[model samples]
Target: MITLINNPVQLKRELLKVVQKELKDEELKVAKSDWHSRRKPIGCGLTIHPGIGCPMQCSYCYIYDMGFSVHATPYSLSGLQLVAALLFNKYFYPTRWGTYLAFGSVTEPFLPNILPKTLEYLKAIVEYLGNPCQVSTKMVINDENVDKLARVGGSKLSILVTVTSLSQYVYLERRAPHPLKRLELVSKLRRKGFKPFIFIRPLLPGLRAEEVDEIVEQAKASGAYGIVVGNLRLSPNIVKRLISEGIDVTKYLRVDLGKLKSGFVDVRVDGDTQTLIRERALSKGLIFLRRACCANTVSQLLSGYNDVACPSLCFLNEKVCEKSCPSQCKVKAGGEPKQFNFHEVIREVLGFDEYEVEVEGHTMYIKLKKPLRDEKSASFALSYLFRRRIRFIYE
Candidate 1:
């Protein structure tokens, strides 16, 4: 019998070695060059793309601005190859309590042609990595596909079904499924023992108060566990598209349209709109999450996984931890042991031999003997491993 490795970094390296031995030289080379093998921004986690480009052509989507074709195509890497690439990633962690794996950032994971690949990738991740996973989609899934998803991920996967507007979906989402249909998908996911959340992303402008209330009521009635509200992010091309669709962009803009050149500009929704949604969600006894990773953490805990606080460390900020969240991550975050052998962890994980360490609350200060070539990735991995904010200093 093979001995199980308990140390996360050692286990991750061992798993990579095993996977590398199984992969062809060309496959390993391709895996190393895959986009998923890089470190993502803080809190975004690692986005696994089952497919590239999107045919749905939602007016507010930023994928087009990033140069993905309007035509959809499944990602080239196979499931095993994808896993190999993730294992090779210097920043990726291996277990459920390790790094968060997110799906459908660049493309809709459940698009008909892409769904098979999505399922394959999910199975591979669950079997090999055991990381907490989340997928956000506006696509409608049928009962059969739901069964397949449940078999592969069950409650371990956090599902976010996007429902932006009931009335404006036709104009806003053009080729995507109706908002009502997507809500049905959420209901189905919930029925199958999945923690599904109604994702109100890019909270479009000019939505009436009653519509928000109705959405909250409908979501609760459909058995959704929670709701996630996201602000609109607009690029110049996105602004032009929305303007052509007859939606007023002026009220949502905080800066001149010319200022939004390449990157996305976050449009601030009024405080009342945000408060109203939060109030309605809380009144209905539904969990409210500001970020997707928070939902991932809650889903893992609710699924009977070991009690792990939010890996994104959102609990450090009280404003981000909604009181309605069942995990009570804020309280759990404070309970982590403040003392541990930092020397062993740094030496094993970062290959650092000499370092001075200080721990204050949820923050860990490390003074390294020398600067690392990639301090950002090192700090990110250490933060996830230690469940603390990692601040690095070099002499």
Candidate 2:
């Protein structure tokens, strides 16, 4: 199942042991997940699923299918999920820094009953772990827990609010809060000095252009630092459910997934519609990005990069390493197409991580002693480093 996408040397496809002695347990853990298909050299990606099940059930959510809780269960998760991953990774992967610890990938982090424990969990990560983490949810939030996250992890943390339509009738998500309420929370998050981002995702193929614009405008007005838009993919069961519920989604979605286990049906977004959305955000000077690898496309990544400012400031405590890019870059999947000395490029430019390197053709993948990031330059530099190999990373 691991397609090489035309890798010339296929070093990445080699066994993890190829870099085993060079990587730590944490790095190895990161290597375990397919990264959903990203070939970046970022540190690690941790998803701590302490809170199971989200009440704000979006019909399009891919969670329940994963068997995470449909209800909040703080005690259900390994309390040490955060600390264990960090300490172990840091112990072994000392030089490389992982950029994110995404939450709510399995369940919402701020469900009402889960909020109190969720706060405690946030406390655990920020206070105990060092990696900057992120989460996106649709639940209505008050300030108490937000403060805990900020205090513990600093701006190295992020809370993404998932709001599909500002329209009452839209109800793209039946159980979640109204779009207006989400707007209020976005503002509150920024006022408290935290960087808030919006995931106006699963932009259903039926989502009207006006609806898309309204979401973007509202996110901007609510003081969101950026917007990560995602499109809706039809899962067989969800599609059937929506049809039975009388929801007309055909025009808004393009995936032919009426039957389960038929494999993943490709979903196509109307190019013109996508263009309209991106253009509006660019005109308004907002940072717009797609939410996934193949879903976001290469051009979306190529456009709208106004964050010349050191985005790490938005990162609270974790040192925001510059993105390691020698220059400004984009919404693209990989980075600038070029090669680097895996060990030397970042070592010379950012001055961190003492590790061994392996170079294959135009690409140079690093095995860092520690994870890197604190400044945008460092982070971008990593992507820039990977861009050299991107031409073959994605086919």
Candidate 3:
């Protein structure tokens, strides 16, 4: 630990404490299973870390446990081997939905530090793994990279902008590009004909709920395909810092420490809020949907029963996103937490483990973890399984 600071020895030590705390702060335990989930919001999304650590270094980020606080910088692409390195077996168990890989949760994907070879590794996952995928980012992406990704993504690539708060003063996102810039990216995405969506997540407590509506409207107008709302889940220290910031963030800081003890944040998106968001969607006349972790629009659609809801981001719209929100993740009362099955993803992108894949009822539902090499065969199988001749595109 190189001593970092201005000299009064005491101040120097204090500064080191700050750095150590920020980097090692209880490790936001982003284990493989922890990152991977079955019933999330972004259409069967995969919250994979392309790399570890972040350049932006936002204080409120939930990924401290990635254990990369002190690296000179994070890895750009979580090298395919690194993916296999995630403690969670699912990373290697290999069923299939390798289709919907997500980037930027644990770190920013577009950071300038990541070299081409790294990006190639990320691209190879989709191309050779045989599944369509998208990445979420907050970095200021350049036109050249966008062009490359656009060319690569074609119709299958998606760029999701994670904008939590729009107010510049909120500084919740100090190093990240401004919300306006993110909105601009949406335009770029549309121009490139790539699917674009806005993830207005981690709704800060002090910020007015109106910010939600403003963002929703802007995203829809800016050529966004849709909007998904999520709430902020804070740790005790995070909540303390938020409230101490001299704002009424307490309204949304209702996280119970008990839930965190159980391994995930208790913050949830619920009823009245869901209804409120839904009404807003109806008024706006847009394709409005909500997601948990990975499912996004697709899971919202899959969660046929509309009564479930997520508790966070319920700061505004009591009933809307709630109306469509799916059930929060939970351990089945009688058994183990349901493992995120990769059957659908696998069968869709590969077919080596040949079998009659189905559609409608049982076809889409899957149990993850199949043979690794069967990736391409799974992609081929989905065509027959779905009985739809749509070509599966990958980046």
- The model with the greatest TM-score is 1
Most accurate candidate by lDDT: 1
Q: Could you give candidate 2's per-residue lDDT for residues 274-296 as a string of tens digits? A: 56766777667666655422111
Q: What is the number of residue pairs that collide in model 1?
A: 0
lDDT of each: 0.82, 0.50, 0.47
Ordered list by lDDT, greatest first: 1, 2, 3
Model 1 lowest lDDT segment of ten: 333-342
lDDT score at residue 159, model 2, on the 0-100 scale? 67
Mark the regions of model 2 whose C-alpha exceeds 4 Å error after superposition.
1-44, 75-81, 85-96, 168-170, 245-247, 251-254, 262-270, 292-362, 365-395
If both were scored by TM-score, which would come out higher, candidate 1 or candidate 2? 1
Total clashing pairs for each candidate: 0, 56, 63
- In model 3, which runs have C-alpha deviations exceeding 4 angstroms? 1-46, 70-99, 115-118, 205-209, 247-250, 258-266, 271-274, 292-395
lDDT of 1 by residue, 54-158 (tens): 999999999999899888899999888998999888888787657888898789999999999999999988888888889999999899999999998877699
Ranking by TM-score: 1, 2, 3
**Reference-based lDDT, residue 350, model 1:** 68
The C-alpha stretches of model 1 lying farther than 4 A from their native spots are: 1-5, 268-270, 335-343, 367-373, 393-395
Whole-model lDDT, candidate 1? 0.82
